[model samples]
Target: MTSDPTVEPGPLARSSAVTVTLLAPVARFSLRARAGDLAALSGALGLDLPQKIGDRAAAGAVEALCLGPDEWHILAPEADAGRLAAAAAAVYDAAPHSLTDISDREVTVMVEGPAAAELLTIGCPRDIDRIAPGRGCRTVMDGVTVLLWRDGPERFRLDIWRSFAPHVIALLRTGCVELATCS
Candidate 1:
């Protein structure tokens, strides 16, 4: 048997202490705006957009993470794509910012367990332990750009580009075994 890169991958890592699975589809957007425009956009989107790097705010099924001084990554239920775009569009005139729908460009991988943070450090450049819970940062894993979300002390969500997912998942699975043995 042979593997084909063109074909999308199936399941990812799974373990008792650490697991990696692809989350169900969600609507994602890359928003770029100035500080003064955040209030208006947040009102329209129904969620406040964090301004400081690594900060995050959420409302309902929607969450906005401040990835930079003027950039944010928004995630919401897939069904809310139209509603989100419409709301942002409505605010464009007043806020004058960019909200690009990036739902299809990347996929969410949830990595959670007692050793989740250590597992991530295998390839991630940052000291994963340093990120405060409920915050996120744009970082690199095995040279791949990823948005690392620290949902809790033991839970993480990696928003990674689809093309590099296979490589990243493979690394994580191998790390799971390494950590499992060290226990």
Candidate 2:
């Protein structure tokens, strides 16, 4: 299918390289830390613990969010994925936290445009607005526990497990396609 050239602003569509996939509009990352070690993990990253990271995440300074007591997910541009993975690993290497490169294990999809929010409603029951911008929540979306973040009014980022990545993507594609047809 042809992309809507006019959908995104000029700079947003610019490519840095031909091989680099700009999953633009949406991207995802998975970060695993030892259970109960998230606080220490953040310290290594120069960020505070718990919801403190979420505060900075909203401003777009850093897109880090706590997924569980021992788990956290850092969302950024697809281009930054490699750097982020290494940075996180080096920080947690000798520490109590165990870091894993889950970049290839999950499907990160970006849902943008005027219908982004509406499309998300198909899989998410939470009030997307309640989470606010830059902030995210760990909730079960369509029976899947997903970390949903509101990066912008028309932008959102979803990180699902590697095994379920394809299914999640299919579901999203179906939802968005259904919206397009309905509208």
Give me the overall lDDT of model 1: 0.87
What tens-digit string does per-residue lDDT give for candidate 1 at 112-177? Answer: 999899899999989888999999999999999999999999999999887787778778889988
Query: How much is the lDDT of residue 32 in candidate 2?
Result: 62
**What is the C-alpha lDDT profile of model 2 across 67-134, one tens digit per residue?**
65555666556676566556667666455655554555454445666777776788889887676776
- Top candidate on TM-score is 1
Error of 2 at 180 (Å): 2.4
The stretch of ten residues in a row with the least summed lDDT in candidate 1 is 1-10
lDDT (Cα atoms) of all candidates against the true structure: 0.87, 0.56
**How many clashes (backbone N, Cα, C below 3 Å) per candidate?**
0, 3
Which runs of model 2 end up more than 4 angstroms from their true locations?
1-43, 46-62, 75-95
